[model samples]
Target: MPQRRRNNRVAVSGATGFIGRALSNFLESNGYEVIRLKRQHFKSKKSQLRTLLKGCSVVINLAGAPIAARKWTPNYKKEILNSRINTTGVLVDAIKEMEPKPELFISASAVGIYDSYEVHDEFSTSYATDFLGTVCQAWEAEACKVQRIKDVRLCIVRLGVVLGNEGGAFPKMLRPFKLGLGAKLGDGHQVFPYIHLNDVLNAFWYIIQHETSSGIYNLVAPQMLSNLEITEAIKQRTKKSILPVIPEKILRMLLGEGANALLIGQKVVPDRLEKDGFTFEFPTIEAVLDDLIC
Candidate 1:
């Protein structure tokens, strides 16, 4: 697969998702043709999918169930794991049958792959043993199958808490702050590894532009911040005073295991990305909130 053979055409599996929609627009603005691979496309015959994938230079797999969508019942736990593993499996199987597989296959993972106990880089093996960590591990493992496909390079991005205005965690947090109900989660000591949505779009384009880029990359900002700091940043923008901490017990009770997504987070940094010369547009919580709230 020669570089630029496809004329910058790309296929994305989770086009309807928050990140996916943002990424698609970014790609198109950069003069690349974007193909939205909806859920139905994954369910259809592989031959049909192969048709859609024709001439695509890259295939991005961002298709996964939202980790914090609901309380994690035992069945819902299965839903999280299956949504990631199954969709990646289906996409990989289809790519294998292609006469000329895409030049690159990029998959989405999360910082939750690491346990809350340690600061991690891309090489750390300190994996989390909890359900969220387990799902993230399995998600990357399934995505790794793309490595076996000849001519297809795999790039896995372990994302941090994404902050943006269009959609995602920021908008949800904004409503409470606007209502003067903003409060820190748990003890507010947990590190909130976060990145802006614009940087995410640029990172994908960076991977596409850097043909040699492959393997796992921790997609986070250079600055490390605590949940309390993020709350303070938001408060500065919304002119809301801080409320008392929301006890961990209360979140756990409401979200069950799902509260871990908010109450617990890893201190992850973008070591590999910076080492590769990729720079973030918004590197701190202050910058992120300024862009979204101002």
Candidate 2:
């Protein structure tokens, strides 16, 4: 493998978010200068955004409103789309105007873009028509605009559920299982694609370091598990008895449209990532659970 340039500058939007915070720390610790771009910067003026991004070798855009943060009301849904698309649009436009453009442009997408049933890889064309799927599609579309710029390697990472000790769904998941109320969500048939926090950071760093690494890549573990499979894994790890399954109707009633996130999921695999030789620190749900639990 080629050695990364010492002091290679990288500008990252959404640096305060869960993945962004971790990524920024990882880059800095590895001798890369990371500039955190705020939403306010994009809202200010293009010149300011350009000035902030200028001279950086890599640009990572992860700006998006939290989908699971609140009820998916009409206004909140609009906020989610606008946050991702608008921020990405600003970055893409700024990249176009940059003198010496960043070598690599990496943006975020979600596996929710794929339909619920069957396995999906980078090559699969089937996409969901729901709210999240539409959001992911539009987010990627804005990111694809960077391709028009000459010599810029564009990589769109379709993220799976990110599991980590801090900040992600992992912390919330621990609450139920810890209380011995661990149970499958919905029918437990929907395949959930997930990745460890370590792998997520490594994938971003891997793409930036390897000049040839570009295009859409699924940032997920090779082992795709159904909800029942994951629940069982948690049960084994915690040594706790499983409770009754939570019905989809209950989740829907509580979360509204956001329940689709838990009820419907894609069986996404990181084929390109593995083919590219990126190793996972936590390859299986068992491994992930053990690391985080016992």
Candidate 3:
């Protein structure tokens, strides 16, 4: 892929995270100076944030605890919430202090902001009350506050499940199928919205470079498949059979509320991303699985 021009100096929070690392590397390789903002030990939050963001042309916020971490205990839940909220809060506060603010603010969000087990697009209004949905809602809400600062453009990307060979939801899923233990979860009717990692990176770059882009955009592929359909597709592509579906009740008993969030499904499509002229490299699950597995 050809790189974009290095016109913007970017500051990124959560630069060490999965998507963050990928985005930072892409930006740097493309000739942008990227600075990572880390939590300070002795320095106050404001001071450290201000120092890191000074003179930056853009700020990309991808900081958040992984939602898939096991057993969402009270402490873990608090950590999940604070990690995202505090990171955005810090960045927003810092931008407010900077004399000349960054032109673009790109923040991360998840498709979970919509109702679980239902189809949603950028225009979808149905939102779930589940923990994941609430987290995404709060995360995007905090990031939106950046718009209040004059001359700042805010873009919130509501991401779907990201598929990549390196690090993401794919390897863990492949483990079960590779071991022949993989089976469809729940009723297998829930829609699973997903996107290729490369597409995600491209979308970010496009939004950052296009001055007209702003507001909430769905970062997902055109194809939306059910849990069973995805399993079958993987099975066909990998030449493996996944029978004997995993019962939803059993998953609930084992994984609790988190299991419901995972096992249940949502059919989401990127109506806005496509309409805005962004293209997907892998639109179908079969294509995605073929590329990643092979």
Candidate 4:
């Protein structure tokens, strides 16, 4: 573990979401003051989001609609885009309105910001027309506006699939595997870029304390494994058999265009985070599964 830095007051949006809740608790446990931004109520509008953020030195923006919570209906897609973009826009406006703006702004992004079919690093070119890609592009663009505020440090984290025991992909995957119904998807060739929940919490702390860190960093473990490899590992851990594989066409027919993004693979590595001296607690798929399963 790295040496702890000076404590600072931090404000977080989406404090109720999976990562948001975990990060808020982690920061509070580590002696940092955490303020949560909640939605406005008509009766007592005095609790404005800007007011809640007052005097905070760092702002961690994690507020966004859950992408996998629902089927990709057109209306839901609009809401998804609006939720991220609007929340970010509001945060930017609030910061601008603050008398003493936060010193550092750590915003959330997704690896989806890059082309889905190809691997991407911090310096990768933008490929913004795809569904998830466009959402991430807009979200990051909104966060970049904070740089215009003098003396403010802005960093964006492109997170991979977060694996945890609680509300995340892990639990859903675990259910089927535990029931002995688990199987690989779409030839099981798609890459699964993942990070342990503990590592993710530590990464946020590390970035917040390290003043020199800025720009986009991929918040993923060093290891990138294909879906088949992950399923096989899970089977080994659970003593289950590998069932029939779901073909890509079937998944596409069932999940629409978004299915391709899940079925296809990308071999992303966290080159920037590694160069920045951050170490992952679970750097391999087998290690991660062992921790999560057992």
Residue by residue across 23-97, what tens digits does model 1's lDDT show?
Answer: 998999989899999999878888889999887878999998888778999999998899899999988888888
In the range 1-294, model 4's lDDT, one tens digit per residue, is 444444478999888889999999999998889997754411234347667888898999998888776567788788889888888888887888886888789999988777656777888875646788878998999999988888889999999889999787889887888878888998787788889999999989888888888898888889888999888889889997656776777767766766755676566789988987778889998889889887
Per-residue error at 197 for model 4, in Å? Answer: 0.8
Taking every candidate in turn, the Cα RMSD to the unseen true structure, in Å, is 1.8, 1.2, 2.4, 2.4
lDDT of each: 0.89, 0.90, 0.82, 0.82
Ranking by TM-score: 2, 1, 3, 4
Residue pairs clashing in model 3 are none
Model 4, residue 116: displacement in angstroms?
3.4
Looking at candidate 4, the ten consecutive residues that score lowest on lDDT are 38-47
Determine the backbone clash count of candidate 1. Answer: 0
Which residue pairs overlap in candidate 4's backbone?
none
lDDT of 3 by residue, 128-172 (tens): 788888888888889888888999999999998898888878898
lDDT of 4 at 287: 84
Q: Which candidate's TM-score is highest?
A: 2
The pairs that clash in candidate 1 are: none
**RMSD from true fold, candidate 2:** 1.2
Model 2 lDDT, residue 191, Cα: 88
Best model per lDDT? 2
Candidate 3 deviant stretches above 4 angstroms: 1-6, 41-45
Q: TM-score for every candidate vs. truth?
A: 0.96, 0.97, 0.93, 0.93
Which one wins by TM-score: 3 or 4? 3
- Give stretches of model 4 more than 4 Å off: 1-7, 41-47, 126-128
Ranking by lDDT: 2, 1, 4, 3
